[model samples]
Target chain A: MSEEQNKQTLVAQETITAEVNSSDTIMDVFVRGARKGWKVAIDNIIPNVLMAYVCIKVLNVTGVLAWFGTAFAPVMAIWGLPGQAIMVILGALMSMGGAVGVAMSLFNDGTLNGTHISILMPAIYLLGSKIQYLGRLLGTAGVPGKHYPVLLGISFVNAAIAMFVMKIIAP
Target chain B: MEELKRKAVKVPISGYIALMIALVIFSGLMAKVGGGWTMLDFDTLNGKFGLMKSATASFMGQGGSGARDGFLFALSLAPGVMLALGLMEIVEHYGGLKAAQRLLTPILRPILGIPGICCVALVSSLQSTDAGAGMTKALRENKDITGNELLIFTAFQFTAGGIIGNYLASGSALFSYMTVPISVPLAVMLVMKLFGANMMRLYCKMFVQEEK
Candidate 1:
């Protein structure tokens, strides 16, 4: 072989050797790992899905929800959101996934329309985080010092501003 | 002596267990007063799909509507997930993240008024929420952080993703103009810069900022 061809052969050999060393039991290891990962995912998915179900489907707490909507009237006015907008924001505060669930519901019901969407998307984007869990989980586990209030407050305020802005530009 | 004591501290297992017990008791009492919990409306999945179909049809002829939906969906996740992957590729290829970190060192020190080394926690948090989880796991494993540091990081991490990856892809089209060559990343960073400064000021007032 010419020098160039010889160099190519050397490189190919190096590649084959690296592949062999890195993935010696590639199929077996990959299969076992995938099985283990799926097992954990399945285990965790049950409680989470169940809790989400309970919060959204079962909690027919419209009385409280209406209160939330009314309280958010000023905030809604900021974004020019209808009173109904607060319901979705309330949904989001409860759970981002849940709020998405609620927003999707409202949009489906024809409660949101037009440039109204652009206004709401930013709010949904902002106020909607997996935040409530942070309070329960982080306050319990984030750190030892009494910074929970500070952390939680900043996150909420940040999300709140995003939502308020969205309420403003909704046509 | 005070500094040494702070470095050596750990939450006693007994104390942590006691706290858990207290929480459980508190939760039980709250539950008893509040009654049972309920489910989310996720089973209304049909409604979600129906909305999508209708929105698509309504905005069918409208210019930029389809593009807006597609763009917003990607914007919501791209900065955190796709960008992280893109960054990993760049780091693997050019070894630039280290350089970036090194360049950021002088600014991170006084910018947030935290230790220069602690900037990695902030950066990692901005990139991915789970990445910050990994950082916390490492810190716990290594016993590197004190209780106070954990609180500080918790506050920081919760607020980190807002400016960077989270807001990068979604709704800034209004600001960026369609198909222009302007810098979206810079725009997102600027938002973070503005918000992050206010956030740090707010947090400092709420908690004691330890001087390094």
Candidate 2:
């Protein structure tokens, strides 16, 4: 074979070896992914879940939730929710899991019906995680200073739409 | 010369198009009718709560119901979140995410009014909005996306943070509340989110100046 052909063959062999060495097997990928996934779930989700549990427990036990719900009942009535749903909204403001916890409690006790859940779920899902989204996510994403208000406005609009649409569909 | 002169025929089927169609159809079906798998249940808890009511109504009363039920419901989400996130990680590790990013870029670019690379950020956002936002920020810092693009993207992320994980984790509670299938609300939320993002896109185009 010509010297040029020989050089090409050597280069090809080296490339193949490098590719093989660098590629992880499916099992390895799966294991690594699973580990990372669990870490994320634990780090991000578990705390929120725990927080929700605690928040609901405290609010219910103290009767503060009921009082707060009564105070906000008129506002909630506008959205077809029980005054107690104020807890869910408050919980959502704090964390997504907290909102879920509140919702679960209310749903289980027959405080908030399916229609209420439908209206609240989309609103909470869309608007929850406020601190993380506003402080960390958008703040870090380098959004322009001028756009902040606009973005906030859009968030409210989305929440409003979710609430209205879900109310119509579920109610 | 003859081979070079031969015309290339356009085929209707493409892998990406097919996948997109399948996803839409599947989501529609799931939304209209409930998913087959019943991943979480409150029946046992209901029975237990009934027994508790009869036996120790005064001792362990309604005061703790919120905490007790909330804790159990949160626990119920664990399995689904673990599985969904774990599978996402595996797909990401296998270059499936990258391939998806590439395939989705062109399609998303015109609709979202952003570069194709934004698809990666969008997909990542589906699992964890924070991570997705962080990734988009990195992309912005690296000059992979513009500020206006960031605004539009953030609009989407903000509206529907952690789409799949959120759905799976919270769907049970939502399902119990609404007689409608979980997918129906999910689909509705997604559409509203997309609409919100596009609205931002239009706003940016009309009002905001392009970053130099």
Interface RMSD of each: 13.0, 9.0
Question: What is the per-residue lDDT of model 2 for residues B75-96, given as tens digits with 9 covering 90 to 100?
Answer: 5555545444454444444344
What fraction of the true interface does each of the listed models get right, in terms of native contacts kept? 0.06, 0.43
lDDT of 1 by residue, A1-171 (tens): 456334433432221121223343434433443453334233432232234334433333435545655776786766666666776655545544334444433444455554444555444444445365364336433454355556556665655565454344332
| True-structure RMSD for candidate 1 | 18.5
**Decoy 1 TM-score against native:** 0.49
Q: Could you give the C-alpha RMSD of every candidate to the true structure, in order shown?
A: 18.5, 10.0
Candidate 2 lDDT at B60 equals: 29
- Give stretches of model 2 more than 4 Å off: A1-42, B1-70, B86-103, B170-177
TM-score of each: 0.49, 0.71
lDDT of 1 at B109: 39
Count clashing residue pairs per candidate. Answer: 19, 1
- Candidate 1 per-residue lDDT, tens place, B3-47, comes to 212322322343334333322321223332332321111111101
Candidate 1 chain B: 10-residue stretch with minimal lDDT: B38-47
What's the residue-level lDDT of B51 in candidate 2?
Answer: 38
